[model samples]
Target chain A: MSRLAALVRGLDPRLKLGTALFLGPALWLMGLVQAGVCAVALLCIVAALASGQPLGGRMVRGLLVFVVFWVAVKAGLDAVSGMEWAQVAAGAGDLAVRLAALLLLGLSLALSASARALGLAVAWAVRPVAGGERAWKLALSLALMVHFLPMCLATVAEIRQALARRCPRCGFFLRMTVIPQAVIRALGQKTWNQTLAVAGRGLDGPQAWEPDFSWSGRDTRCALVAGGFLVWISLSLPFLS
Target chain B: MITVTDLDYVYPGGQGALDRVSLSIRPGTLVGLVGANGSGKSTLMALMAGLYTPTSGSITVDGCVNPGEGRAVRAVCRLVMQDADLQMLGATAEEDLLLGRARTDATVARARELARRFSLLPAWERPVQTLSWGMKRKVCLAAALLDDPRVLLLDEPFSGLDYPGMREMRGLLRESRAVGLTQVVSSHDLECFIDLVDQLVVLDTGRLALDGPPDAVLNHVRSHGVRPPCSWSAGQGVRSWDEESL
Candidate 1:
């Protein structure tokens, strides 16, 4: 809710999205030397939560899934390398930290930023890459992704509830599969309804209302802090070798 | 108010629900288009809302054939679909209406006004997944009416209204009619709209079958040995319709 509250109250929206883009990937790569990166990610998480921007509950669930996958991947890598138990444990711990750093940081960015801010930031980024309608199209797609990501998660929850309620007489293959299938069906239905309401509504080009965001002093400081961290990370990575 | 001329529509399976159906509706008139399950009543409504493009022919509103042309079809006209579930877009009824309204064009004060007019809606906004059937229908109806559209299309609208709700709906429709608003309400349930609708349009296997006044259609059906739109067997005074129709 803090994430939502901050977004509603308005911040340097462009800074929010710009922060997300670079921070997201940096966290993921930091898995190479996990501990420090995780600490950084945790800072991001704390900042995001403090913002009072409401994040989807499903996002937390997804991060948990990622954690499971990351751990499994790290364990598998250690096993394949045939490392000693001590080294393997250390490696696993490091990888886990790295994965957490990436996921938590990504989540913080997604939670703290509003769609308008995200769109504006992307537009700024894309302006040089692509011109005219193409840039806006990319921006619109990104905007849709940001707004609809939460909605899709909410939808999957409703489907799950419906699927849970389906009490088949026997645990036949069809019965077991039906529950998952019902979820797909529900999603399709929701999509169809969107198509319905959007029929005459133009899907072409950018909408009349583009997001308004300005890079403020707060933004400059945040960017500089990130730059400083990058410098430190680069300097430390050589020492690790 | 509304006119359909030689409207032809073919579904995915090549099912022709509406085939060259033509009907004219006057302003301040409540027109009822009744038909069986696959008789193309819903298809016609879809065409009217510009949700689906007709294969051929034309559907005009206040003289405009295409809804995509301008504000006539969009601003003056709106459709309330058969499935009330399709209508509830936002977490709450008020939010639902706002989402459909172009965000840039809408203001919080205007939204509040529309919500207040359909005051029953605020109660429907809960977990949204937990609203009762009638309340859901009401929420959907409220969404369609937001921004005060000039012509209303209620496809099987009176599906789950209680006695009081139905009465309230009738009052709204009458008020709309009195103000010279055009409305096309499609339903097989003729009992409730006996007085509400001025024109009757019946669809039979994708063709316009009956189009006239309620009394005239009744007389025509009786004389031709066809069943009346409503099953009135003898002199039973018009049953006051309070139950909702889907």
Candidate 2:
């Protein structure tokens, strides 16, 4: 692994999550040039973290498709609202960069840590306000969501493929209606089965939950780097604008 | 041991999946559950795994009552669901194998040992989504076995497996049985279980239609919407689908 990747992976998950949470709003509020620089930096970090992982390339490609599609929609809307062509292009580009940065931040965290670690981080973050039991419950729910999101996506894709095979020339309107209903039914059944599977593993309660993380010098360094980056972004905002 | 006495499971929608089903499974024996679609095979396995409380009757696994001692029953029984995708709740094979368990060095070692035994160590760190259908099933099986439950309930274990995958699953089942782990495998593919299972239990429209040794139940499975193994129809008495047997 690259040094950057090793550093991020060894950093505590709570620090990674905290950085992402802070960086999201920071990216959104930044000037276009600043956002672009941050986006590029985040992308590199994401790439480093994604190295040697199977789903990394797919995630990056998915992010590209998402950004492009949304940017096109946003630009078209701005044009319809009678915005100047130059402004429309600039606004769309800015939105695309910020969106990509946010997604890259999320992808980096996901690639760097396991679901359990992220879940524990969530629990720790929420424990003060939500109480121990409720915090753990929320954390477990988040972990289950992370675990099943891929399977849900795969199911949706399979349903779409089956529908296409059955009716090659199906209307777009019909597909929109049919697909959601089918997906909901399929996912509902899957959720029930998953609940049973989870229960069978004796995870219905939070009594056995334990955090498998500890602080280290690397974590301290990571927090310091994140703090410095945020400070730099704040200090440069006025000059960039 | 698993004991089901007059088990009736009625869904909230007023649909009955299992109706007065009664059966007993002795410890360490492999029981093959056969039926048609919606014949309650899956429901019975879920009930045995303590996923659901029987609507009227009772299910006891390793002497733990289903409704009364749900957690204890769950501890003693593990169910591998029909869709391996649904059962897996981990990003990677190793993660899934160690799900719901303490992540100590001993547990991690045990998970790796199970993975190696299942030939899953090579894909130990690979995302579960990238695995083949058979490999995904193996990962679920390995995860189910990690807790060392007394009874393992497998729903449609052979649904998506090819010849080699099926052979590997059969081998795993045989190994588990040898270790005195009671197993109830629900499958529509009777051929895979004919020569391997100690008892064949057939469910017909939510009722027990046949329960006996494979030879006795093989001839009657056809009446319950299940096809008899091809060899049985060919007058080959209780033959396995294994290539060498063929």
Candidate 3:
């Protein structure tokens, strides 16, 4: 994990996003879909390691819920319809792997990407299709959304704790009394003031859409390797299907 | 130094908060802002901190004007908000201090030093919720001072603090004053700040009622709905419960 993380820690965010974007469609096309799943899983692992994020209990629980509701439900339905156990098992395994790959990709991206870097990536991606102002606005909105997520979570947690302390015997409904107001307050004047503070710390004014990414020797080598792999997989598609 | 020249503020709903409120605070002094509830103390402090633009008139912090170049004013004068929880953007003290700022090795070291100075080193890694209100206040103060702003506007700094906590804050304010940091602390509670403040500025119904040295303003302090210190209230008062009985 350390070795994988070290490799990914300094990997350009743009390159990471591009590779993830390309990998998804490529993973869908391969006949032996496990190969694509494994590849995505590897990337997710690298991302997690690089970001130094622990695989927390909450994530495990969420994965369990997803598997039960999404993967297991389909498998059980197939079996009830008299599909063979072997086929059902195979389908379930395939779906589970694919789901895991997608989840990992998302987790890695969320963990490793900074708001500014992600904003730059989004703006750059949209610049050709959209003009610069719209691109930058969309990017800034996305960055602000990313920044607000953690703040909202913390606010909820703090409100919960405050209620608990003031009323230990407080009913769940009673405890939730402040949640709506807290959310409104957090998203309202508080968020605006925070944004002002952030801007005051030198993020104000007309921002140039200059993304700080440069192609290095390593990027070229990785690109070539990825291109060769994609070509080989596409060429071998007929045999797999 | 902060100079407010004929400052006027009106809320969006046509409610006036401050009207022609003019005052000047010199460098390296601790000034107390006293007013009743909704008396424009907080509004004036917010204006000084550059949180809100003055609807009319102006505020100059170290020669930087508000309503424009507000960021410059904020850079020189930071406000420690009344609600510590609202200002604490980080789960821990160190994280809060690092927000919106680069966390270089030097910055991290400076954060540690500030935390220690503010007696927050023990709870530096702990979640802000785990700390007492005083500790949380201290963390907010430390976070504000991380950039070493020349002026601090502390709104209700002693609210909810115990006796020892109040003493500690008084000492901290005194120490900051010694080092030439201008501070304007607004609080409805006058007892806590009376001894520490060099001058008392009283606001009554969005207007300046009195402004003078604390020793000279005890009569106006009571007139403006504030209870002066016990020493002044007991015998040297213009009117008191004892005096009224006689």
Candidate 4:
């Protein structure tokens, strides 16, 4: 696992995302909705894996849930306006591609960039916007919160289990109110204990994760390729219309 | 140096767990809080451990004392806690050790070293859930000892240990104390605690009844039957085991 982590440290996270974005619109122009988009999205998935991000199962389940939502939204839209099959396909295809790209891009970014490194990168990238002590803290906290987002997901599952009962109005009420309330009720000593542990040690200092990027031939070439892809995609927009 | 004077604690449900309790523990003494179940032993320990606030009276540590100051109080004095399962906050054995020491480069090696020495489970990078009850307890103890604090508060330090295991534990505690570490281990088992604790405390209900040397208290309790006289006064507290054997 440590070796795998070391291997991931070799690749540039930005390059992975750039690759996905470059391929997405290019594939859309190729008129191969499922094949091209799927290929691009699948490549992004491979990047996520190579970066040591374990999201295969999570992505599968999330896409399944998104399918249900897409169907419901599609049905509502069809009822409101009679649309042609080409338009429907485009809408659904775009929807699927957009969703897949977003998911895979997110995974790539997460896998390639660590919380500390990303915080440093963000702190560097958004220099003017992120210029205060509070801004730095906010950026660090946001990074930590994003990194620990999966912890809250387990709580959501627990809440769903609690709401696993037969009802219409009450079930609706629970769906609306249960999750947040359950989280509140379930916040126990462990969280406070961990915080106390950190605070007690005086370890909660300003995380000066200053970004350190060095320009190499690979980086320069990658950036040029990315820029060209964007230009091509921009020119092809009218053709799609 | 914690002095609990007329300390009383009750739960939110209006359950009177602790009555007025007064006790003073001098520095450099290994005190063990002991009692039967529901005797307010854990309640008073909880007050000292900073888990709960006394309803009335004062709970002080090293002359600096306050009620419900567990977070601050706990900083000076660390508690390993009674429940081992609740102590784990990491995803894996290595991560468990890295819970607080994540920033350091030697954190993994340090954790692995302690895990090996302290009988921590899942020998590999397996999840904490894979460990046994005893293994979890050892890991919790290792985590507590990692900081090497001025004071160590252990609840049932030897609950799941055999004779040899307890001896190994004693060696660990001995090493911890050799360097000015004040330890308070709250436990009911005084039999195996022959060489472990230096001081003894008995909580009869939420109130303190006995505080003195372990040997003196042990002899007194034995002579008068485990339950002391309904009303008793302190004199020459614990007679050293020179009379018997430590």
TM-score of each: 0.71, 0.91, 0.68, 0.61
RMSD per candidate (Å) reads 5.9, 2.9, 7.4, 8.0
TM-score pick, better of 2 and 4: 2
**lDDT tens digits, residue span B28-78, model 1:** 788887766677877788788767777888778776675354345655677
Task: Indicate the worst ten consecutive residues by lDDT in candidate 4 chain B.
Answer: B224-233
Assess each prediction's global lDDT (C-alpha) against the native.
Answer: 0.63, 0.85, 0.73, 0.61
Model 1: runs farther than 4 Å from truth?
A: A1-13, A30-59, A105-132, A135-192, A200-209, A212-241, B67-76, B82-106, B120-148, B159-175, B188-195, B215-246
Model 4 lDDT per residue over B1-246, tens place: 878888888888899998888877777667777776677765666677666767889888865576756556655766776666556554456645654454454766777777777766444455555576666767777877676565777777788877666766676677666666778887766654545567788876655667787556765654322443222234443332233333
Clash pairs, model 4 backbone:
B1-B62, B60-B65, B216-B238, B216-B239
Residue lDDT tens for model 3, B1-246: 888899999999899999999988888889999989999987888788777899999999998999796878877877887767656645457666665455568978999988888888888766555679999899878777776888988988999999888877887887788888999999998777676778889999999999888778877687888878776777653322221121
TM-score: which is higher, 3 or 4?
3
Q: Write the per-residue lDDT of candidate 2 for residues A1-241, one digit (tens) a residue.
A: 4788877777888898888887788887777776788898888888887776777888899999999999999999999999999999988988899999988888888888877778889898888898988977877788888888777888899999999999899999999999999999999988888888778766677753556668899788778877988887876565554
Please report the candidate that would top DockQ against the real structure.
2
Better of 3 and 4 by lDDT: 3
Q: What order do candidates take by lDDT, descending? A: 2, 3, 1, 4
Model 3, position B244: C-alpha lDDT score:
19
Q: What is the lDDT of residue A146 in candidate 4?
A: 54
Q: After superposition, how far is residue A157 of candidate 1 from its true place, in Å?
A: 7.7
Candidate 3 per-residue lDDT over residues A187-226, each given as its tens digit? 6876766654444333333253355455678767767775
A96-178, model 4: which lDDT tens digit per residue?
66555555555555555555445545555566675756545654565556544655676677767767743434666657786
Q: What is the interface RMSD of candidate 3, in Å?
A: 5.8
Instruction: Flag regions of model 4 displaced more than 4 Å.
Output: A1-6, A9-60, A107-183, A188-241, B1-21, B24-30, B34-75, B82-112, B119-141, B155-180, B186-195, B202-205, B209-246
By TM-score, is 1 or 3 better?
A: 1
Q: List the per-model TM-score of the A chain.
A: 0.74, 0.90, 0.75, 0.67
